[model samples]
Target chain A: MRLINQRLSPGAGAVLKTLPFVALVLAYLLGSALRLAENPNDKLLPALTTLADAIDRMAFTADPRSGAYLFWTDTLASLGRLAAGLGLATLIALLVGMAVGMLPVLRALLAPFIGFVSMVPPLALLPVLFIVMGLGETSKITLIVIGVAPIMVRDLAQKVLDLPREQIVKAETLSASTWLIGLRVVLPQVLPRLLTALRLQLGPAFLFLIAAEAISADSGLGYRIFLVRRYLSMDVIFPYVAWITLLAALADYGLDRLRRKLFPWSELEGAR
Target chain B: MTALSIENVWKEYGDQIVLENLTLEIAPRSFVALVGPSGCGKTTLLRMLLGQEQPTRGRILLDGTPLPPEPGPDRGVVYQRYSVFPHLTVLGNVMLGPELQANRLTGRSFGAARRALADQAREMIAAVGLAGAEAKYPAQLSGGMQQRLALAQALMMKPRVLLLDEPFGALDPGIRTEIHHLMKRLWNELPMTVVMVTHDLREAFTLGTRIVALDRTRSRPEELLRYGATVTKDIAIWPPRVAGRATLYDTEHPQAQDDLTAFASPAGTTRQTPSLI
Candidate 1:
């Protein structure tokens, strides 16, 4: 069979997808066994049992000092910040992006500034955000927003600009005012694109959130990970990192589902 | 009913003039087709009529009043594509104009008002032969059906003038013929003037009660910037199809009578036996 023409059955495709993941686990186990066999006291490559024990200690058991499960607490704290930052970013991106896109005066005023801000490395502004907003939850949330909002705004504005000019002209002929045009013609179409932009910004938002948490947070996944690094708790650190990755993946899947549910017409557009 | 009068309109984009010294008097219920080759500014003139682009010079009067500077519900337009909003379903798209007109703030009607709007929209949809596809989005519709929905959407506004920029140019031949009949029926039924722009001469002859051809007198690149396209031929259809009342013979230009002799049927041919169709 030709390579491009070859097709996999559903059962075969499922197994093919699992093979690499299973192989990675097997490779890790083999390496851990070899390292442990050489040095019984080694903390670098803990056995699977040690990792499972750490998961139980962090997740099931309560911390002696705080009397709360650190893993659950950290997850909740991080998730709360992520939601707030993302929600704020979405609102700002919609309003400012629509203004910059639909109005020539506003586009001239803000489009260049947004482009310049988006070009700046968001991580470089972490210190400034922390200093201005302080070391509270506000600073951490602001870091995520500052990291993602400009890019999201730029993306949504471009989406608006790329819309067919005929649609706007048609809307105007329908007696639509400027505000009505934005609300009816532009907003509904730009919404799906906004969700897409939000999906793409998730990874960067997480990076900024973790960076902020690692720097000065009292309780978060990143804080917990950085706090235990001195003691070299690789077992707990590995599970925390995996947990974060799982959360991000789940959020991405949920957003994709929401977009499909809300804007089914966009699927036919083959929009990115 | 509304009549449109264009007096010596000129459209120039910087150094390049698109249209020059164009003048036309569109009757109250006439279907005037602006036919031209590409870049000859038939679409530009249509855009000017639709209030999308203002004439760089000269004037356009609707019902003897100066046209509003921007597009309004007083005029409706259908393009070759993107005439309907994809985000809205067939019913929603049809009702949008009325909804926005009734409620400026929300652009929506509610309760009994919305129900009434839906009924009118459904009636318009049925008029365009799209009765069963109310819930379907524009993306779910075929090109012909989308154009039908666009016609319904534009008609829902009941504008004084309907501007079509090759509204059926994107449809297949079979669909185009079907929609041409629908277009003719709508023009006959509604009280509005139509100005359509098409590159297809057969389409112009098939649907237009009067055909106006535009072309440049000069062809050189340097002359192209200095000179612009103007009306080269203006021919009125024989056995004239007028709606509501008979049109007087004075509307026909005697100078263009000899121009359409090559395309028209023989002198003794019946009214139904025109060669252009």
Candidate 2:
């Protein structure tokens, strides 16, 4: 039924799509080899066996001082904070953004202020947050919320505003009030975009979370990285940083799956 | 009795005048197709009738009473796009109005009423030839099916006056004919009053019982803004004919013209064939 030519097959296309990631790994390997050839004692590019050993020490063994597996404890702590911060930010964005987007009076009142707030560098608020909220869990979580919520609100509000005006007018003809329109017409359309906004905010959210943790934390991946910087222990730091990257990637993949499962229509519309 | 009345209506946006000194009263169960030049205010008038935009001066009335400040079940409209809710299945979209009304009256969805409403919606969807596709979403439908779904949804409310703004503008000729026949059937069967605005002269000719041509007839540019758009030509194209009844008279009969224009203004100008836009 089919003839095979020199052109790419489906399997080949899949491999082609992942070529860049493979190339990145190869480049890192080459750089590590060259650096180690020059200086066997260099901490800048630790050997792979040394990094594997460091992972075992951090992940398999418990820290004698704290009697806890450091890797798991750090992962759990950072994940909890990330989840809480993102959840709170999403709630704030949905409520405030929908209100502002739907009502003209509210849009006029808060839209400009939101724009100004988004423009302010989120890192600049870290010091103020630290002084006000104390260098506790509250401030670190607040730092992520402050860093990501405004931009998310702006994005989701624009999505609501961008909905076709005809739909609103049509809803009104059905005798739908403002509240019913929000519930029936706007919410379903906005929900998938919320997932998209969450995916986009992941990078910045992680940035703020780590920054907050690095500055002051007894236990976190960021804290360990900074604590080991004095000894230039590239083995532990590299593994920890790679772990964070893996976690972020997993979060993104999970969101994409959820969006596909929940709102399959989004994919169809996008194909257009 | 008059179904809708527009008295000395004027609409303007900042400095540009859209409609001026427009006066007309539509009697019960009349199909008036409005055609005009591209920017000569047909849409503006439709918006006013739909209660989406109000005239800067004068008033619009329905059943000899002023319309409510907000759009409701009393007035129904179908636009060119996004007419049907995308998230709803065909049956769900058709059932929205009755379900909403039922909710308002009872504070909950009654089992019997919902079943009765579903039956009614299914019958209407069958009338529009969308019976089997009742579970399909708007995106899954073709453009023609989507327009038919919109028609079914709007008709479910059974509004006093239905406003259509080129609801079939995107349809192909075959589907357009199907819709035309479907619309004529619905209009006659329900005896509903209709106001449709279209860019196609053929459509205005085929569907409109009374064709009213809207245009700025002013020759002078300065005074043009004064009488922005008026009923330059109002013609009786077809005598009102019931589906089962035989035709009584031709539109050219002076008595038929006189009868058609009774509620419309006494325009000294006779019906003239409109130059195509």
Candidate 3:
């Protein structure tokens, strides 16, 4: 059969799905083995045992001075900042986007401003945020909000605008007040789109969070990764990087599942 | 019963004109089907009646009073597409009108009130033949089922005027017939005025008691913008089909059924009745 026409069995498909991952792991193992063979102590590529030992020390054991589990603490701190920033951004985007999209006066006033702001690189505002908000949790959370909120707002506003005008007219004829139209009509439809926009913005949100943490944080996943870099501890750095990647993947998966469960209509064929 | 009057209404968009010097008096409980060629401002006239667009030159009155500057519960509308809220389930869509009207701020009711509303909504849904699909979203429905749901949603509000802007224009011939039956039944049962815009003349004859046509007198490119559409023909169906009157169509008269079957068939296959014109 032609390659395009070939269909994989379920078991074959599963194996094929894992092939690239298996290849990657094997290649990493081979590199580590080769590096360790040349030097008894190589910090570039730690062996599996060294990586496992680093994980145990960071996760199972508490920090001797602070008496806190470093891995859990870092994860909690990072997750808290992410939740706060994204939550605030979600609320603002829902409000501002709906207003700009639905009301002509608001659109005339704010659309241009939002367009301009969305163009400005959010990372460039990091120092400004720090200088204004101070070097606390607020600054880190604000960085994520500033980084993701404008794009989210723009996306949500466009989504609202793209909605068929018929629906709005129908709602009006149903005797919905402007406020009720926003709450019942526009809000329900935009929520799933908002979740989708958030999923797309997660990578950038994390980037800003980490960048802000790396430059000026006492504790976080980014803080730990940057902190251990000076010691040339590839073992810790490697595990932490892997852990971050796993967390991001898990978050993305969870968000997608949530969107499907909450708004199954969105997943329907031809639904926008 | 509510009567609507459009007094020399003209809708102009800057230099371009859409509707010009339109004067119409629609009786209470009348089914007025406005038909015309595309871009003849038929839908534009419907929008003006619904208060979505204001007439630049004249006033529209409902029940001897000026229409509210905006669309209100007094007027309900269904469009060719997007008539139902996609996010809402069938039951929710039907109940939305009463719920929003009953509670001003939250648009919700609680406990016994909510249950009562749900029961009413379920009854309405069932009336439109969507009894078992209460939990399904609009997107889950076929185009025909969705139009049924939209009909139920609009009728639940019990508006004084029901405006249909090609509500079944996108449906298949078979489904359109089904919806036409439901629409006739609803008009017979309800005490509301209905103004429907359609491109299909057969559909207008099938459902409307009065048929009105809009067209431009001058079609020249230079004159297109200079002349807006006006009512070219005003027709009242013979043997006067009035609301609350059991029409032959609703009674399943043998001849009416034959006409419908002919209407459903491919064009030019069978001779249509003069009444169907």
lDDT of each: 0.89, 0.84, 0.89
lDDT of 2 by residue, B65-103 (tens): 887766787778888898887777788899887777666
Q: What is each candidate's DockQ, to 2 decimals?
A: 0.65, 0.36, 0.76
| Backbone clashes counted, model 1 | 0
**Model 1 over residues A133-152: C-alpha lDDT tens digits?**
89999988888888899999
Query: For residues A32-123, could you state the per-residue lDDT of candidate 3 as single tens digits?
Result: 99999999799999999999999999999999999999999998999899999999998999999999999999999999999998888988
For candidate 2, the per-residue lDDT at B142 reads 86
Could you tell me the lDDT of residue A201 within candidate 3?
83
TM-score of each: 0.93, 0.90, 0.92
Which scores higher on TM-score, 2 or 3?
3
lDDT of 3 by residue, B136-221 (tens): 98888999889889989998899999999998889878678777888888888999999999999999999999999999988999
Candidate 2 per-residue lDDT over residues A83-113, each given as its tens digit: 8899999999999889888999999999999
The regions of model 3 sitting more than 4 angstroms off are A1-8, B247-277
